[model samples]
Target: MKLLASGVFALATLMASSALAQAQAPANYGPAIPGVCVYYGAQTLAQSTVGQSVSTRMNALSQEVAGELAPYAQSIETEITALQQGRASIPPAELQSRSQAVEQRIREAQQLEQTRQNELRYTLDVQRRAIATAVDPIIVAVYQERGCGLLLDRESVYLMNPAMDITPTVIERLNVALPSLSFNRLQVPVDQQQAQ
Candidate 1:
């Protein structure tokens, strides 16, 4: 009789455990609705008028930096070559002083390059932000007009229909709404800015 009672108790426990497991299971919410519109952000930005202007500014800045730093860069190269080739002939004191000067110039050049890069980055960011601010409303209007429930980045999506791509239209509208954005370099005081 005790054995039969134990068996019945085990069966009841199993049944309760099964019921608890089922209760704890998450409810099915079904599949998500797919985004209807895809936008190639990089392509759109590249094709936009503001983007082209930003590119032009960036290129100009690069050229200016190269022009300014070319002499220093050449000096460093010459110093390195001289040290390697003339180490035996150069007196110890002169060699030490020249080495120190070369090192200082290298550090200065590196710092200047970093500063220029930071300024360029800052300008680009400001320009892109302006473009985004101008384009966001247009994107929403296009999405709504097309009856798209959602918009997704084309870069992230693995597969999509060409018909659903809205990049061209977005870029077209962006150019009209924002033909150009003036990028102003932020003047952070050298003292306040971190030592590059």
Candidate 2:
């Protein structure tokens, strides 16, 4: 009688456990499958008109700036070569002074280069903002059309199915809507004066 009772208890516990597992299934499963959209900013930017134009202008500007500093760099280099080649008898004190002067000139050139590059970066930021501004509407439209709630960066994604990516359409629409960065991309979506 005790053995039969033990078997019955065991069967009851197993049945209860199975029932609990089934009841908890809804918590682990989602109501609808979530899909993701990915965008590659660098690739899209490279293909955009604003990006190309910005790159071209910056390259030209860099060349011009390099030209301005090239002569001083050559002078320093030539002095070093001359010192090495024994073209002149350099006294220890004189050599130290000359070396310091050359180093100073190189530092000045480096500072100028960095400053100009920073200025170029500012220019690029402005251009990028313009491009992003222009692309927003198209991105919104595409998002709406595709029923996507979220947009993701392509770079950070570790592992995702290729079917989830949405960069191509975004790139196409961006190119269509924004041929250049000269245009202001935003307009009044809602009347703000009325709110005041």
Could you say which candidate leads in TM-score?
A: 1
Model 1 TM-score, 2 decimals: 0.72
Tell me, by lDDT, which candidate is best: 1
* Model 1 clashing residue pairs (backbone): none
C-alpha lDDT of residue 189 in model 2: 25
Model 2 Cα RMSD, 1 decimal: 21.5
lDDT by residue (1-196, candidate 2, tens digit) is 2222343465466457546754654433323325556666765676566566655555565566567778877887998887676636778788788888878888987876655555545555677787888778877787677777777886676445545567678787777777665422122223532332
**What lDDT, from 0 to 1, does candidate 1 have?**
0.73
Scanning candidate 1 in windows of ten residues, the lowest lDDT window is 1-10
Return the lDDT, model 1, position 25. Answer: 48
lDDT of 2 at 14: 48
Question: Per-residue CA lDDT of candidate 1, range 31-55, in tens?
Answer: 4445588877666666689777776
TM-scores of the candidates in the order shown: 0.72, 0.61
